[model samples]
Target: MKVDALYREQEQLAKKAVFYDAFGKLDSIAGIDCSYYGDLIIGGAVVIDLNTLEPVEKAHTILKLDFPYIPGLLAYREAKAMISACRKLKSDVDVLMIDGFGTNHPRRCGIATQIGLQLEMPTIGVGKSFLCGNIRDDGYVYQGAERTGKLIYSSRSKKPVYVSPGHRISLDTSVELVEKCMKSDRIPEPTRLAHEYVTGVKNTLK
Candidate 1:
């Protein structure tokens, strides 16, 4: 994919994000994760009921890579497969959690933000490693000089994961929802289920 094209899409995505929802009531949470098998991408989407915190439905898809595995341009490489899997969900996704950065990107339009904007739904980025955000004394995350997201320190986590608003959600609310869905020390339950599903599928195919 062309850098110019991604930039163009990022520009448009930013504009759409301005119209995002930050206070929508959430009932169901959807999480997405992508794994690779050589040159192929396998994506999984899992929808979990917030009240029960158990996966209600799961979907997966495999696709040929269309873009390079660049650090910041992962949305271009992975979003299509994820969207395909997300389409299989029977329940409505009130909030989405993705295995990547949200506003914590160079362009503030990472994969989570891109897909969230595309779906016009509330989304949060749940990254295990630090991407491009700094944590403050009070735990606010800043990218460069502007505040973008926050860090969630799990009792069982060796390192904190970055949490940021992807689309149609506030940074605070993003953290709250992630904490609600978390059943592990490192990752949230919704995303953990999606990751396990994709990992199992990728291993089987390999």
Candidate 2:
């Protein structure tokens, strides 16, 4: 019954997400990721200057795992900590790049979508792996006939990353911005750094 309620909440929030670019300015972007250690989860957010690709601000929050790990309902388990980390950022990022799915999910509401809706901020989801949808010949992922996201290989020798609009952003813009933020790694810098940041925080406990 609780899971059913969560699914309904996702459906409602997904409807509220704007599938177009609704934000002004493109100066900075924040990357959000969460790391785990035992029963603790550490959420990290790192804001980077777009032109320079240098981190301007970063924040993190450590919390106990209050929610169980569910496959399709990750937002319910990790979004609270990620939101706390994002709220701690003093820098006004133009968009958030989260390491999860967005509209690519079965319910069209992934962790990235949930965070963007809850925060009312522009966001993109840069997923390391596919959660749903099948890749068509054009390299775009589709849920049945509707396009969900795109798959692009940041490194030709490595696996591709999935790019999708989370909220207040368009699929084209999401792909463009993620390409700009890409460094030598397959993961975009904002999310890649945030992953490192949170991992480092988790390591300190060991």
Worst 10 residues of 2 by lDDT: 151-160
Candidate 1 off by > 4 Å: 19-23
Alpha-carbon error at 42 in model 1, in Å?
0.8
Assess each prediction's global lDDT (C-alpha) against the native.
0.84, 0.91
Pick by TM-score: which candidate is best? 2
In model 2, where do residues sit more than 4 Å from their true spots? Answer: none
lDDT (tens digit, per residue) of candidate 2 on 153-173? 886436999998899999999
Clashes of 1: 1
Q: Tell me the tens digit of each residue's lDDT in model 1 across 85-196.
A: 9987878888889999888877888888899878877788998877776678988788778778788877787777788888888787888888888776588898889999
**Model 2 quality (TM-score):** 0.97
